[model samples]
Target: MTLTKQHVRDVVDIYIRAWTKQDPDLILSIFTEDATYHERVLGEPIATHGGIRDYWQSKVVESQANIECELLSLYVDGETAIVEWEARFDDLVRGIRKRMREVALLEFDGALIRSLREYWASETIG
Candidate 1:
């Protein structure tokens, strides 16, 4: 299956919307039952369930204010989508606000995502 621009937009919107304290179940339903996601900037031996939940929970807890992520670019081919994005938050590592660029590769089985691998820059500046 291939993703169209609408599909990419929908996926991005779903993620951003989930960040706004929406129903966690709605967000969880967007992915496949066995979906796998990795945050290359941190963690190891993590998959879905605890891994993904911990990642997002930590982000919200770390930020002093609202954490925001925006879509910069998105490209899809075959069953995979590559998303280039930016996010702003009170850095949990540094305890200050900064922006960082993240690039992610997402694979979908039809409309439901199956796997996501995201990479972020190690060095972030204000």
Candidate 2:
């Protein structure tokens, strides 16, 4: 199926919602069974649904709170979507409030994300 801009937006909305709500399952729903998620530019990707679930469970659900994510911009071409976003959250593990700016490249398999690569920078605000 040809990917539409609205489809991309809907998926992105779900991603933001999942993060803000700290719902690992919701985030996982948008990915393919063998999807690869690159949380950092230079880090190894977390592959497959189970790996992603564990990562999200620990990093997002367990260690982050009061999360907020905003979609700053998005561009879609063929089966790929590139998005820029800003987020603010309390880092439970680090004991600091953080503000992050991120850009992600999402490659889609139909409506699900087959691979995601993220580049981001963050600073402690408090």
Candidate 3:
């Protein structure tokens, strides 16, 4: 099935909500039950909702990182999409603010994301 603009918009909204809230339930709502998530420079891929929940909890919610994202571009073909985005966050762990530009390769199951591989480079901000 072709991925519609509405679908991309919905996914992007969910993505923003997930980061802004850092709520596991809200994050899980954007993914299929058996979805997979990977951050290229990070550790191993998380392949279950429970794993994703834990990952997000430790890395985001528990750390109390405030995140903001800007959607740069989105390209869709069939059930897959590539999204370019910029994110800025306070890294409580490192005691610094950071900015990252990332591209996410996403595979969708209907409106939900089934697989997301994110590639990013982060810079420390003044």
Candidate 4:
């Protein structure tokens, strides 16, 4: 497996597309065999259970369902990328979603994501 500029873009696109559709498998496929997912909550990093099944059973899919994210910016350094996201919850039960910013730090092994650390604000309601 080789890393190229196009692979990174495709991975990010797959990420956004999966998030938009709330498709767990598509989301999971972007990850490597031993991928780790972390979310920064209340100034502490919450390590999620491995793989997409755990993610769907845990928080990512649930949190993702209520909102839609737009890519704000992306910066790449070798096999990593820091992506800025802006999301809005379109559903009424979720209330008026505040514009929240999150930075996804992706670590890639080849074209697969080996790890992800997503940092977001807890104060903002989704």
Clashes of each: 0, 0, 0, 0
lDDT for model 4: 0.68
A best-first ranking of the candidates according to their lDDT comes to 2, 3, 1, 4
With candidate 4 superimposed using the best TM-score fit, by how many Å does residue 56's alpha carbon deviate from the native?
3.0
- Candidate number with the higher lDDT (1 or 4): 1
TM-score of each: 0.78, 0.97, 0.92, 0.74
Worst 10 residues of 3 by lDDT: 39-48
Candidate 3 residue 27 C-alpha distance from true site, Å = 1.0
**Which candidate tops lDDT?**
2
- The sequence of per-residue lDDT tens digits that candidate 2 reaches over residues 41-89 is 6888999999999999999999999998999999999999999999999
Model 1: per-residue Cα lDDT over 1-126, one tens digit each: 567878977987897677645335556666776778776636552467565666566655444345677899998888888999887666656667777789988888889888888888744446
Mark the regions of model 3 whose C-alpha exceeds 4 Å error after superposition.
41-43
lDDT of every model, 2 decimals: 0.72, 0.95, 0.87, 0.68
**Alpha-carbon lDDT of model 1:** 0.72
Give the clashing residue pairs of candidate 1, or none: none
Q: Which candidate has the highest TM-score of all?
A: 2
- How big is the positional error of residue 7 in model 2, measured in Å on the Cα after superposition? 0.6
Ranking by TM-score: 2, 3, 1, 4
Better of 1 and 4 by TM-score: 1
